[model samples]
Target: MEKHPRVKLHFTLTRSSWLNVIERWTGQPERNTLYHGCFTSVKDLRETIKIFIDSHNTHSAKPFRWSQAADAILASVDPARTSMILNS
Candidate 1:
């Protein structure tokens, strides 16, 4: 960390499900295509995930955006911190 001063650290809650959408989304691919499956090479794995991603995007993917910055978003739910949400 000292050697790489430009790199900063940010921590997240271990038990927050609402903020773990990436984990949830990634699990779908693993369970749908990778689980109990065999891949002979890296190319096969990439192609499989690519196909799954393309199909999912075409049929099921929804648009997403971050309405707030990281600090504002995290502060909203953090008990130790206060944001506009807490005051309201």
Candidate 2:
């Protein structure tokens, strides 16, 4: 905290490695796509990775089931508040 006071820390709860779903998915893509593709130079490899990531993100499903984090937060806040918040 002292070393990087400007940087915010995000800590996920234990037993919830699934919270890092993006990284897990990325590793598989690397092994299946990038790793198998031949690259003659570092620039070639970098460009290939950039293209793959852009294409992957374009075709991938939304990160969370909910459209927005705010919506999820409001929905989970209180069952009573759900009607008011969502309708508001």
lDDT of every model, 2 decimals? 0.80, 0.69
Residue ranges of candidate 1 with Cα displaced over 4 Å: 1-18, 65-88
Model 1 Cα RMSD, 1 decimal: 9.1
Task: Summarize candidate 1's per-residue lDDT along 10-80 as a digit string, tens digits.
Answer: 55456676667888889998999999779999999999999999999999999878789999977766773
- Write down the TM-score of every candidate: 0.56, 0.47
Positional deviation of residue 7's Cα in model 2 after best superposition, in angstroms = 29
Q: Where is model 2 more than 4 Å wrong at Cα? A: 1-13, 18-20, 63-88
State how far residue 22 of model 2 sits from its true place (Å): 3.3
Best by TM-score: 1
Model 1, 21: alpha-carbon shift in Å?
A: 0.9
lDDT of 1: 0.80
Task: Name the lDDT value of residue 72 in candidate 1.
Answer: 91
